[model samples]
Each structure stands twice: as C-alpha cells, then as structure tokens.
Target: MTPGARIAAAIDILDAITAGAAAEQALTQWARRSRFAGAKDRAAVRDHVFDALRRWRSAGAAGGGQSGRAVMIGLLREDGTDPAQLFTGERHAPEPLSHDEAQVPEPTPARGVRWNLPDWLLPEFAESLGAHAEATAQALQSRAPVTLRVNLRKASRAEAQDALQAEGILCAPNPLCATALTVTEGARRVKQSAPFAQGWIELQDAASQAVVAALPSGARCLDYCAGGGGKALAMAADGRTTFAHDIDAGRMKDLPSRAQRAGAAIRLLDRAGLEQERPFDVVLCDAPCSGSGAWRRAPHGKWTLTPERLAELTAVQDSILDTAKDLVGAGGHLVYATCSVLRRENEDRIAAFLAGHNGWFCRLEQRFDIQQHGDGFFTAHLTRVKL
Candidate 1:
C-alpha cells in the first residue's frame, strides 16, 4: 500500500487507541477487517498510532482539534510534511482536508503540553522529581528504548551482541547493568530473530534488570509479588535460585514457559505454598503502586490513576511488604521495589516499614530515574538486624 494509505489507516486506528482501547488491540481489530493491509502496512500504521499517542497533547494543539484526522495532520505538520500528500482524495487515502484544514496553523503547544501529561499529573511530576521534573515529563512523550537482558547463563555480553547483530538487531551495551542491552536498531524484528527464538535474549527493561542485579546473591530467593515473573526470571538467570509467588496464582501461568525459554528455573508457588516455604535467604517485594514511572510504556495508566487509587495501591504495597517480611530468614534481606516515581510510594513507604519493624535496617541501595535507558524504578535493600 502507498504511504498515504497507511496514514489513512492510522487515523482510523488512532480513534480507537485514544478512546481507551489498548493500542495493540485496536491495531489487531483494524487488521482483522482490513484484509488488504499487509504486515508492513500494519506495522507502519502502528507506528503512526503510537507516535500520535506519545505526543497526543502537542499534536492536538498543532492540528487545531482533537479528532483523529486532526492529530494525524498535526503529527505530519510536526514532521514538516504536507498533510495533503497523505490526505489526498485518491483511493484508500483519507478524504482531502477541508479549505479551513488546508490552512496550516501556527506551531503553538497546548498549555502544559510539553509534559505531554494530563493536568492532574503535572503537579505530581513536579513534586516527585523537583528540579528534574520537566525533563522526566518530557521523556515520557517519546517511545521507550527496546531493552534486552543478555541471558548470561547462555552467552557473554560480547557474544550476545555479535549474535544479535548477525540477526539484524543492533544492541548497545547499557551502563545501567552488566546484563542489560539496549536495542538501538531493528528492535521490532527481535521477536522473529534467531537469538530470540533460541532464548539468548529476554525483552526486559534495563532498569528492571538493574533492580535484580543489585540483590545480594543467595542460594534461596523468593519473589513475593512476582506478577508476570519478569524479575523472577531475571533473578533466576543470575543463578541465585529463584522462587516466584503472587497473591493471584494465575498471574504466573506463563512463567513456566518463559523460564524454560530463557533456560532459567523458577519455582511457582501459590499463597499457601509461600507460607509453607518460609525463611528464605532473600524475599523480594516488587510491589504494586501507581505506574507513574512507567507511564511512557503504559500511557493509559497516567490518565486513569487518581489520588484515591494511588492511596489504595500504597495500602496494598504495605500489606505485601508486611506479609513477605515473614518469609525472610533472620539474617535474610527483604528488598522493596516499585515502578512509581512518587516519594509516597518509594522512600515514604520504606520509612514507614522501618518504623514498624524495630529490628530492620535499610541498606539504602541505589535508585534509578526514568531516562533513555529504561523506566523510573526504585529498589531498597534491608536486613533484619535484631529480634
């Protein structure tokens, strides 16, 4: 299909994407009906849809309206392209822009559009990040880097890089962690690449990899809230002997296959099983909270999250920590983590935990801010020092 056709298709998909439909779901639904759209067409259309989402507010401002067509026009304008070229009145292309639409508006940004965030979140970002707030907000407006964790058990960093490069995927060594690689080019082809099929690489963010890398290596470890078991897989890959459990046992259904593919062993346990396997060498709580730090990847969460909802998440986080604490041995480490950039969830929660547990002492480990390498993540290491 012609480039113009892709643009037209993107406009239709964007309507669904902006209206709360999952981006992947909207594209899949569009593909099901449009048999004429090829794989290339679908990928191109998806790019347009995500680009519009990444800069929705600014794009809406440039296009003079918030409709799908206007946002596409705004996107094209931002790229200095003539929208008429795509909105041509030809077959499968969008209808020609109206006379009023033909007039390119001034490049003015929406109020607080630079942050590319909802009005409610602007103050929160500022309060959380302080001086770096604007940069953090601006970073969320762009796509996140495609990061991979080199299965060190399978291959060395240099070996993995060479292997992936041969398969047309360019990966750069990430400074965040020894096992992390940032896919600089051909990232979209990774899933179909030979290395991926062989499980030489796992699509995990560098920041997430860093969190597990910081853990004190132990023979027995438990990921107390192992949602999807990504961190559990990474910890297992490091050969620390990993076990995974979630309050909802169903969340770990795919973990067995994922672990097998990555050549890592993860023991899946339900809440009852976790209770039976107490006093582990290390207990990790990658707790749930407002995913503000990860808004770039899951943009919908930013708009959906509310103050009340955040409060509820923190309560759950605390409970997870309290429950998981009992599973750690007398000399074991109880690690706390969250995807939230908010102080209330990260530092504040840790403070509250220390206050509640008289004998516990925090190791005050590293924290990662959201940037090009990965999403915003916080991890703190603590150990039981007393009765």
Candidate 2:
C-alpha cells in the first residue's frame, strides 16, 4: 500500500476507535477486511493509530477538530508533513480536505492538551513528579524501548547478547539490571530468534527486571499478585524456590508452560494452596494501578482511566498489601511494587501500609523513571524490624 493509503487506513481505524471500538479491535477489523495490505503496511497503520492516541488531544486540536481525519491531518502537520499529500482525492487515499479542514488551527493553550493527558491527571502528575512531570509526560507521548531479560539460569549476559545478535536482534546492556538488555534493532525478529525460543531470554521491561533485582535474596519467595508470572519466573532464575499466585487463577494458565520453557521451576498456588504454604521468606505484591507509566504501550488506558477507577485501584492495592503481609514471616521482605509514576499509587500506598502496620518499615525503595531505556516503576522493600 502507498503511504497515503496507510494514512487513510489509520484514519478509518481511528474513527472506529473514536466511536467506542477498542484500538486493537478496530485495527484488527481493518486488517481482516484489507487482506491486500502487507505486513509493513499493517505495521505502519498501527503505528499511526497509536501515535494519534498518544497525542490525541494535541493532534485533535492541531488538526482543527475531533474527527479521525482531522486528527490524522493534525498528526501529519505536527510532524511538519503536508497533509494535502495524504488527503488527496486519488485512489486509495483519504478524501480531499474541505476548505475549513485545510486551515490548521493553533492548538488550545491548555496543559492537558499540551501534555496529551486527561485534565484531571495534569494536577496528579504535577503533584507526583513536580519538576519532572513535564518530562515524564513528554516521555509517555513516545514509544517504549523493547527490552529483554537474559535468563541467567540459561545463559550469561554476554552469551545471550551474542545469540540474540546472531539472529539480528541487536541489543545492548541495560543499566537498570545486569540481566537486562535493551533491544537496539531488529526487535521484531526476537520472537523468531533461537535464543528466545531456547529460553536464553525473556521479553521484559528493564525497570520491571530492576524490581526483581532489588529484592533481598531469600530461599523461598511468593509473588502474591503474579499476573503472567513474569517476576516469579525471574526470581526462580536465581535458583530460589519461587511460588506464584493471583486472585484470578486463569491469568496464570500459561505460567506452567512458560516456567517449563524458561527452565525455571515456579510453583503455582491457588488461594487454598497459598494458605497451605504459609509464611514465605519474601512476598512480592506487584499490585495493579492506573498503569500511567506504561501508557506508551497502552495509550488507550490514559483516556479510559477515571478518578473512580483510580480510587478503586488504590483500595485494591491496600488490600493486597494487607493480605500479602500475612504471608510474610518475621524478618521476611514484603515487597510492594507498581508500574505507575503517580505517587498516590506508589509512595503514598507504601506510606499508608507502614502507617497501618506496626513493626514494619521500608528498608529500600527505588523509582525507575521513563527514559530511553524503560518504563516507570516503583518498588519498596519492607521488613518487620526482625524483633
């Protein structure tokens, strides 16, 4: 497909998305109907759709209206491209712009639009990050880096890097963790790479890996909210006895296979199983949150999150911390983590947890900011004063 054709496809998908269809579903629908579109065409169209989502407010403003055509026009204009080239009346291209649409309007001078965030979230970001809020907001407007964690249980960092490079999946060491690698090129080839299929590597954000690296070594560990068992598998790579559990047991249906593929032994526990195996040496609660830090990968979440939803998430976080604490024995680490940049979800939750419980104090804490390397993540290590 021509570049103009791709833009036209993006506009249609965006229109469907604006009309309440999910971005992924809309894109899938488009792909299903347009069997003539090649892989690169589909990828380009998907990129355009997500880029518009990441800067929806700003793009809508610049494009002169809320419609998908206007937003695509605005996106092209924002990138200093001539929208006229893509919105031509030629075959397979977007319709020619109307006279009013031809005139690009100056974007409204609103912080919410400027930062491409919901109006209610602007103050939250400000309160959470202060001076770094703008940078963090800007970072979320771009794509996240593709990162992988070397399964040290299978291969050394150097060895994994070499194997990945052999398959054209270029990578460099990530500073967030010794076992982490940021894919520099050919990231799309990673799934087909021999290293990945052989369990020499696993795709995970560097910041997420850093959270595991920060945990105090223990003979036995439990991931209380182990959705997909990423952290549980990571912990097991160190030869620790790792157990995984989630309130929704269905979320871990693939965990057993994943653990086997990674050559890591991770025991899956239901509520009854967890109750039977009391008091682990370390318990990690990777609670759910607004997912603000990962908005780059799931931009639809930014628009969908509401104050009520955030409140509900905070309550869940608190409850998880409260329940997971019971499974931590004396002197054991109760690690709380979230992939959210908002303090209300991270530090504030930790503060509340410490306030409600006696004898427990945070021993170490770290916040990984969104940068060229990884998504924002916060983790804190809490231990009962070992009395």
Candidate 3:
C-alpha cells in the first residue's frame, strides 16, 4: 500500500477508537478486512494510530477538532509534517484538508494539553515527578524502546548478544541492567529469531529487568501478584526456587510453557498451594496500577484511567502488600513494586503499608524514571523490624 493509503487506514482506525472501539480491536478489525494490506502497511497504519493517540489532546487542538481527520492533521503538524502530503485526494488517500484544516493553530499554553495528558492528571504528575513531570509526559508521546533481558541461566549477556546479532537483530547493552539489551534494529523479527526460540532472551523493559536484578539474596521467592509471570521467570532464572501466584490463576496458564522454554523452574500456586508453600525467603508484589509509566506502549490507558480507578488500584495495592507480608519468613524480604510514575501508587502506597504494618520497615527504595531506555518503575524492599 502507498504511504497515503496507510494514513487513510490509520484515520479509519482512529475514528473507530474515537467511537469507543479499543485501538487494538479497531486495528485488528481493519486488518482482517483488508487482506490486501501487507505486513509493513499494517505496521505503518498501527504506528500512525498510536502516535495520534499519544498526543490526542495536543493533536486535537492543533487540528481544530477531535475528528479522526482533524487529529491526523494535528499529529502531522506537531511532527513538522504537512498534512497535505498524506491527506492528498489521490486513490486510497485520506480526503484533502479543507482551508480551515490547513491553517495551523498556535500551540496551547495549558500544561495538560501541551503534555498530551488529561487535565485531571497534571497535578498528580507534578506532585509525583516534580520538575521531571513535563519531560516524562513528553517521553510518553513517542514509541517505547524494544528491550530484551538475557536469560543468564541459559547464556551470558555477551553470548546472547552475539546470537541475537546473528539473526540480524542488532542490539546495544542497556545501562539499566547488566542483563538488558536494547534492540537497535530488526525488533519485528525478534520473536521468530533462533535466540528467542532457544530462550536466550525474553522481551522485557530494561527497568523491569533492573527491578528483578535489585532483589536481595534469597533461596526461595514468591511473586505474589505474578500476572504473566515475567518477574517470576526472571527470579527463577537467578537459580532461586521461585513460585508464582495470582488471584486470577488463568493469567498463568502459559507460564509453565514459558518457564520450560527459558529453562527456569517456577512453581505455579493457587491460593491453597500458596498457603502450603508459605514462608518464602522473598516475596515480590508487582502490583497493578494506572500503568502511567507504560503509556507509551499502551497509550489508551492514559486516556481511560479515572480518579476512581486509581483509588481502587491503590486500595488493591495496599491489600496485596498486607496479604503478602504474612508469607515472608523471619528475616525475609518483602518487595513492593509498580510500573507507575505516580507517587500515589509508588511511595505513597509504601508509606501507607508501613504505617498499617507495625513490625515492618523499609530498607531500600528506588524509582526508575521514564527515559529512552525504559519505562518508569518503583521498587521498595521491606523486612520485619527486630525488637
């Protein structure tokens, strides 16, 4: 498909999203119908849709409206591209811009609009991130880097890098963690690559890898809120007797296969199983949150999150910590983590947990800010207070 055709496809998908369809759902529907579109065409169209979503407010303001066409126009303007190029009236292209659409509006002074975030989130971002809030918001407007964590249990970082490079997947060492490799090229081929098939690497954010790397020494570890078991797998690779449990056991249906592929042993536990395997040396609670740090990968989340939802998430975080604490053995560590940049979900939650749990005290706390290398993350290590 022509570049113009891709833009037209993106406009249609964005329109569906604006009409309440999920971005992924709309994109999938379009793809299923447009069998003639090639892989690159579909990828290009998806990129355009996500790019516009990431800058929804600013794009709408610049284009003078919130329609798909207007937002596309605004997105192009923000990117320093002339909308006329892609909106040409040629076959398969978007309709030509009207005179009003062609006029570029001045940039908005409102921080929320300028930062491409909801108005309600501005104060939260400011309070959570301080001077870095605007920069962090700007970072979310672009695509996230493709990072991989070398399965040290299978291969050294250098060995994994060599294997990935052999498959044309260029990579550079990520500074966030010794095991991390930032995919510099050929990211689309990673899943099909031999190294990945052999479990030499797993797709994970560098910061996420760092969170696992910072874990204290322990013979047994339990990922208390293990969703897909990414951290569980990582911890298992460290040679710890790792166990994974989630409230929804269905979320870990594929974990056994994943663990097998990575040559890591992770015992999956239901509530009853968890009770039997209690008193672990370390317990990691990677709680769910607003996912603000990962908005670059899931831009729709930023738009969909509400104050009520955030409050609910914080409550859940607190409850998870409370429950997970009892499973830690004497002198064992309880780790709390989240992939949110908001303090309300990170430091504030830790404070609340410590306040309510008298025998626990925090030992270490770290915040990984959103950058070109990785998403924002927070981790805190807590242990029982000795009398």
Candidate 4:
C-alpha cells in the first residue's frame, strides 16, 4: 500500500476508537477485513493510530475538532508534517483537508492539553512527580524501547548479544539492569530470532528487570500477584525457588509453558495451594495500578482511567500488601511494586500499609522514572520490626 493509503487506514481505525471501539479491536477488525494490506502496511497503520491516541488532546486542539481526520491533521501538524501530503485526494488516500482543517489553530496553553493528558490527571501527576511531571508526560507521547532480559541460566548477556547479532537483530546493553538489552534494530524480528526461540532472552522492560535484580537474598520467593509470571521467571533465573499466584488463576495458565521455555521452575498455586506453601523467604507483590508509567505502550489506558477506577486499584494494592506480608517468614522480606508513577499507587500506598501494619518497616525504596530507555516503576522492600 502507498503511504497515503496507510494514513487513510489509520484515520478509519482512529475513528472507530473515537466511537468507543478499542484501539486493538478496531485495528484487528480492519486487518481481518483488508486482506490486501501487507505486513508493513498493517504496522504503519497501527503506528499512526497509536501516535494519534498518545497525543489525543493536543491533536484535537491543533486540528480544531475531535474527528479522526482532525486528529490526524493535528498529529501531522504536531510532528511538523504538512497534512496535505497524506490527505491527498489520490486513490486510497484520506480526503483532502477542509479549508478550516488546513488552518492550524494557535497553540493551546493549558498544561493538560500541552501534556497530552486528561485535565483531571494534571494534579495527580504534579503531586506524584513535581518537577518531572511535564517531562515524563512528554516521554509518553513517543514510542517505548524494545528491551529483552537475557536468561542467564541459558547464556551470559555477552553470549546472548552475539547470538542476537548473528540473526541481524542488533541490540546494546541496557544500563538499568545487568541482564537487559535494549533492541537497537530489527525489533520486529526478535520473536523469530534463534536466541529467543531457544529461550536465551525474554521480552521485558529494563526497569522491570531491574526490579528483580534489586531483590534481596532469599531461598524461596513468591510472586504474590504474578500475572503472566514475568517476575516469577526472573526470580527463578536468579537462583531462587520461585512460586507464582494470582487471584485469577486463569492468568497463569501459560506460566508453566513459559517457565519450561526459560528452563526455570515456578510452582503455580491457587488460593489453597498458596496456603500450603506459606512462609516464603521473600514475597514480591507486583500489584495492578492505572499503568501510568508505561502509557507509551498502552496509550488508551491513560485516556480510559477514571478517578473511581483509580480508587479501586489503590484499595486492591493495599489489600495485596496486607495479605502478602503475612506469608513472609521470620526475617523474610516483603517487596511491593507497581508500574505506576502516581504517588497514590506507590509511596502513598506504602505509607498506608506501614501505618496499618505495626510490625513492618520499609528498608529500601526506589523509583525508576520514564526515560528514553525504560518505563517508570516503583519498588519498596519491607521487613518485620523484630523486637
């Protein structure tokens, strides 16, 4: 397909999203219907749609409307590209911009519009991030880096790098974690690479890998909220006997296969099984949140999150911390973590947990800010106050 054709496709998908269809659902439906579109065409269209979603507010303001065409025009303007190039009246291209659409509006001075976030979230971001809020919001407007964690049990980071390079997938060491590699090129081919097929690497953010690397010494570890078991696999690779449990057991259905591929042993547990396997040396609660830090990968989340939903998530985080702490044995460590930059989900939750639980005290706390290389993350280590 021509570049114009891709932009037209993106406009249609974005329109569906504006009409309440999920971004992924709209993209998938379009792909299924447009059998003539090639892989490159599909990828390009998807990128355009996500870029528009990431800058929804700013794009709407610049284009003077919220329609898909207007958003595309605004997005192009923001990127310094003339909308005329892609909105040409050629076959398979979007309709030519209207006279009004052609006139770019004056820049919006509202921080929420400038930051490409909802108006309600400005105070939350400021409260959570202070001086770094605007920069972090800007970072979410771009693409996230593709990163992989080397399975040290299968190959050293150097050996994994060599194997990936042999397959034409270029990567460089990520500074955030010793085991992480930021994919510099051929990111689309990573899943098909021999090293990945052989379990030498797993797709994970560098900040997520660093959370595991910072874990204290422990013989047994339980990932208390182990959705998909990424951290569980990392813990097992670090030479700990790892166990994984989630309230929804179905979330762990693929964990056994993933564990096998990584040559790591992770025992999956239901509520009953978790009770039987209690008293772990370390318990890691990577609880759910609004996912603000990694919005680059899931931009729709930033738009969909509401104050009520955020309150629900905070309650869940607190409950998970309360429950997981009891499973830690004497002198054991209980670690709380989230992929959110909001203080309500990170520092505030920790403070509430410590206030309610008398015998526990925090030992270490770290925050990974959103960067060109890694997602934002927070982790805190807590230990019992032995009298």
Candidate 5:
C-alpha cells in the first residue's frame, strides 16, 4: 500500500474505534476484510491508528474536526506531510483535501493535548511527580522504549545481545536493571528473532525487572497475583522454585506453555492450590491498579480509568495483599508492588499495611521513576520481625 493508502486505512479504523469498537477489534475487522493488504501494510496502518489514538485530542484539534478525514489531515499536518500530494484521490488513497482542508493551522498547544493525557490526570501527575511531572507527562506522549529480559538460565547477556543483533534487532544494556536490554532499533523484528524464539529473552520493562531484582532471594517463592506470569517467569530465571497463583485460573492457561519454553518450573496454582502451598519463604504481589505509569505502552488504559474505578482497584489490591500475607511463613517477606506512580497506590498503601499489621518492619523501599528507561514502578519489602 502507498503512504496515502495507509493513512486512509488508519482513518477508517479510528472512526470505528470512536464509534465504540475496541482498537484491536476494529483493527482485526479491517485486516480480515482487506486480505489484499500485505503484512507490512497492515502493520503500518495499525501503527498510524494507534499514533492517532495516543494523541486523540491533539489530532482532533489540529484536524479542525473529529471526522475520519479530519484526523488523517491532523496526523499529516502534525507530521508536516502535504495532504494535497498524498490525498490525490488515486487508487486506495484518501480523497483530495478540500480547499478549506488545505489550510493547515499553526501548531498551538493546549495543556492536556501537550501532555497527551486527559485533563483530570494533569493535577494527579503534578501531585505525584512534583517538578518532574511535565517531563514524565511528555514522555507518555511518545512511544515507549522496548526492553527485553535476558534469561540467565538460558544465555548470558553478551550472548543474547549478539543473537538479537544478528536478527537485525539492536539492543544495548539498560541501566535500570542488569538483566534488561533496551531495544534501540528493529524492535518490530524482535518476536521473530532466534533468541526470543529459543526463550533466551522475554519482553519486559527495565523497571519491572528491577522490581523483581530488588527482592530478597529465596528458593521457595509465590507470585500471589501472577497475572500472565511475567514476574513468575522472572523469578524462575533467578533460580527460584516458583509457584504462581491468581484468583482466576483461566488467566494462566498459557503460562505452562511459556514456562515449558523457558525450561523453567513455574507451577500454576488456583485458590485451593495456594491454600495447599502455604507458607512460602517469599510472597510477591504485583497488584492491579490504575497503571498510570504504564500509559505510554497502553494508552487506552489511561482514558478508561476513573476515580471510582481506582477506588475499586485499591480495594482489590488490599484484599490480594491480605490473602497473600497468610501464605508467608514466620520470618518470611511480603513484598508489595504496583506500576502506578500515584502516592495513594504506592507509599500510602504500604504505610497502611505497616500501620494495620504490628510486628512487621519495613526493609527496603525501591522506586524507579518514569525517566528510568521504562515505566515508573514502586516496590516495598516488609518482613515479619516478631512473628
């Protein structure tokens, strides 16, 4: 497909999303109907649509209207692309820009549009981030850097880096975590890389890896809220005997396969299984929350969260911690972690845990900010001293 044609496809997908269809659903429907579009064409079209979504408000403003054509115009204007040259009404290309559409407006900035976030979140960002708020907010406006965790059990960092590079994927050591590599180029080819196929590397944020890296090592470990088993897999690579448990067993269906590929033993446990595997030396809860720090990777989540939903999420985080605490034995460690930058979810929640539970002592508090080459993340270690 031509450049103009890809922009046209993106417009249709954006319209579908604005009409209440999910982004992925709209993309999939478009792909299914247009089997003639090659793999590269489909991927490029998808990228354009997501870029527009990431800056939806700014796109609408620049385009002068919220219609499909307007968004494409806005996107082109934002890129300083000539709409008349691209949209010449050629085959598969978008229609020609009308006389009014040809006049691209000067790039004026609004606070929310500048931040690439909703209006309600600006104050929250300021409160949570202080002086670094603007930089962090600006960071979320663009695509996030992709990082991969080199599985030590399978290959050394040097070896994995070489393998990935041979596949046309460039990576450099990420400073946030020793085990992580920031993909500088060719990230689009990572999945097909031999290192990834052989399970020598797994896609993980540098901050996420650092959170697990800071944990106290133990042979017996439990990931209490092991959603999709990312942390569990990380733990397995750290040479721990890991057990993963989530309330919803359906979420862990592919974990066994993933672990098999990694050649690691991560037992998936249901509620009953967790009860049976009582008293692990370490219990880790990477709880669910607003995911504010991860908006760069999953921008749609930022738009969907509300104050009420956050309240509900905090309640669930508390319950998960309460349930996980009992699974730790005497002299064991209970670690709480969240990918949220909000104080209410991080420091405040840990403070409440310490206040509510006597005889527990805080051991370590580790926070990786958004500028740390990955998403912002917080983790605290609390050990049962008196028990």
Candidate 6:
C-alpha cells in the first residue's frame, strides 16, 4: 500500500477507537478486513494509529476537528509532514483536503489538550511531578523504546550482546541495570532471534529490570501480585526459590511455560496455596495502577483513566500492601511497586501504609522518570522495624 493508503487506514481505525472500540480491537479488525495489506503496510498503519492516539487532543486542535481525516492531517502536520502529499486524491489515497480543512488551527491553550492528557489529570500530574511534570508529559507523546532483560542464568551480558548482534538485533547495555539492554536496531526481529528464542533475553523495560535488581536478596521469595510473572522470572534467574501468586489465578496460566523457557523454577500458588505457605523471606507486590507512566505503550489507558477509577486503584494498592505485609517473614522485606508516576499511587500510598502500619518503615524509595528509553516506574522497599 502507498503511504497515503496507510494514513487513510489509520484515520479509519482512529474513528473506530473514538467511537468506543478499543485501539487494539479496532486495529485488529482493520487488519483482518484488509487482508491485502502486507506486513509493512500493517505496521505503518498501526504506527500512525498509535501516534494519533498519543497526541489525540493536539492533533484534533491542529486538524480543526475530531474526524479521523482532520486528526490524521493534524498528526502529519505535527510531525512536519505535508498533509497534501498523503491526502492526495490519487487512487487508494485519502480525499484531498478542502479549502477550510487546509487551514490548520492553532492548538488551544487548555492544559489537557496541550499536554495530551485528560483535563483532570493535568493538576494530578502537576501535583505528583512538580518541576518534572512537563517533561514527563512530553515524553508520553512519542513511542517507547524497546528494551530486553538478559537472563543472567542463561547468558552473560557479553554473550547475549554477541548473540543478538549475530541475528542483526543490535543492542547496548542500559545504565539502569546490569541485565538490561536497550535495543538499538532490528527490534522487530528480537522475538525470533536465537538469543530471545533460547531465553537468553526477555523483553522488559530497563526500569522494570532495575526494580528486580534493587529487591532485597532472600533464599525464599514470593511475587505477591505476579501478573504474567515478569518480575518472578527475573528473580528466578538468580537461582532463588521463587514463588508466584496473583489475585486472579488465570493471569498466571502461562507462567509455568515461561518459567520453563527461562530455565527457572517458579512455583505458582493460588490463594489456598498461598495461605498454606505462611511467610517468605521477601515479598514483592507489583500492584496495578492507572499505568500513567507507561502510557507511551498503551496510550488508550491515559484517556480512559478517571478519578473514580484512580480512587479504586489506590484502595486496591493499599489492600495489596497490607495483605503482602503478612506474607513477609520476620525482618524480611516487603517491596511495593507501581508503573505509575502519580503520587497517589506511588509515594502517597507508601506514606499511607507507613501511617497505618506501626512496625513497618521505608528503607528505600526511588522513582524512575520516563526517559527517551525507559518507562516511568516507582518502587519502595519497606522492612519491618520490629516483628
């Protein structure tokens, strides 16, 4: 398909998303219907769709309307691309811009539109981030970098780099963690690369990998909220006795297979089983949140989050922390983590926990700001002062 055709496809998908269809579902439906579109065409179209979503408010302002055509035009303009070229009336291209449509409008001074976030969230971001708010907001307007976590048990950093380079997957070490690698090129080929296929590397954000690295060492550990078991698998690479548990047991169905691939022994535990196993040396609670920090990868989440939903999440985070504390053995560590930059979910939650619980005290707290390479993340190590 021509570049114009790809833009047109993106416009349609964006319209579907605006009409309440999920971004992924809309993209999938488009791909299934347009079977003639090749792999490159599909990828290009998907990129356009996500880019538009990431800057939806700004694009709408620049394009002068909420329609898919106008938004696509706005997105192209934002990227400094000539909309006339892609909106040409050529075969398979979008319709030519009308006289009025050609006159792109200046973006509104509204903070949400300018920041490409919900209006209510602007103040929240400001309150949470303070001086760094604008930088964090701007970072979410683009794509996230592809990163990988080298399975230390399977391959050394040098060996993993060599294997990735052999398969045309260029990478460089991430400063955040020893096991982290920033994929410099050929990221699309990583899943099929020899290193990744053989479990030498696992796709994970550098910040996420750093969270595991900072965890207190213990002979026995439990991932209290192990969704997909990424951290559990990371912890297992060190030959620790690892156990995984989640509120929703179904979420861990694939963990056994993933553990097998990584050559790590991770015992999956249900609620009953978790109760049976009284306490662990270390318990990591990678709780759920609004996912504001990693919005670059899931831009739809930024728009969909509401104040009520955020309140609900904070309650859940508190409950998870309180429950996970019980599973931490005497003098053991209970780590709380979230992929959110908002204070209500990160530091605020920690503060609340410390206030309510008498015996626990925070040992270490760190926030990884969203950078050109890594997603926003916050983690805190809490140890019982007296047990």
lDDT of 4 by residue, 234-298 (tens): 99999999999999889999889988989999999888888899889999999999999899999
Give the better candidate number (1 or 3) by lDDT.
3
Cα deviation of 373, candidate 1, in Å: 1.8
The alpha-carbon deviation from the true structure for residue 104 of candidate 3, after best TM-score superposition, in angstroms, is 1.5
Mark the regions of model 1 whose C-alpha exceeds 4 Å error after superposition.
106-111
Query: What is the C-alpha lDDT profile of model 1 across 1-387, one tens digit per residue?
Result: 889889988888888877878877888899998998888888888888888887787878778788889989988988889898889868788999999888877766554777777787777777778998888877877788889988988888899999999988899999998998999999889999888778788898899998998897678999988999999988888888889998888888989998988888899987788778887998989998888788788776775678889889889888888888888888789999988888888888898888887778998756688899999999999898755
Which residue pairs in candidate 6 collide?
none
TM-score of each: 0.94, 0.97, 0.98, 0.98, 0.94, 0.98
Tell how far residue 59 is off in model 6, in angstroms: 1.2
Residue-wise C-alpha lDDT for candidate 5, range 1-387, written one tens digit per residue:
898888889889888887878888989999999999998999899878877777777777788777778877887777777677789789789888888887767666778877777888788888878998888877766777899999999999989999998888999999988999999989889988889888999999999999898888677999988888889999998999899988777888888988988889998887788888888989999999898888777777776778889889888887877778888888889999999988778888888888888878889987778874899899999887743
Lowest-lDDT window of 10 residues in candidate 4? 378-387
Q: Write the per-residue lDDT of candidate 3 for residues 1-387, one digit (tens) a residue.
A: 988888888889999998999889999999999999998999899999999999999999999999988898898888898989888879799888888888888877988898999999999999999999999999999999999999998899999989989889999999999999999999999999999899989999999999999999999999999999999999998899999999999999989999999999899998899889999999999998899999999999999899999999999998999899989988899999999999999999989988888888899999999999999999999997556
lDDT of 6 by residue, 244-347 (tens): 99988889998898888889999998888888986898999999999998999999999889999999999999999988898888889999999999999999
Query: lDDT tens string, model 2, 1-387?
Result: 989999999999999988999888999999999999998899899999999999999999999988889889999999999899888868799989899989879668889988999999999999999999999999999999999999998899999999888878889999889999999999888988899888888999999999998899789999999999999989999789999999999999989988888999999998899889978999999999999999999999999899999999999999999999989988899999999999999999999999999989899878999999999999999996777
The local distance difference test score of model 4 is 0.93
Q: What is the lDDT of candidate 5?
A: 0.85
Predictions in order: lDDT? 0.85, 0.92, 0.92, 0.93, 0.85, 0.91
Error of 6 at 358 (Å): 1.5
The lDDT, on a scale of 0 to 1, for candidate 3 is 0.92
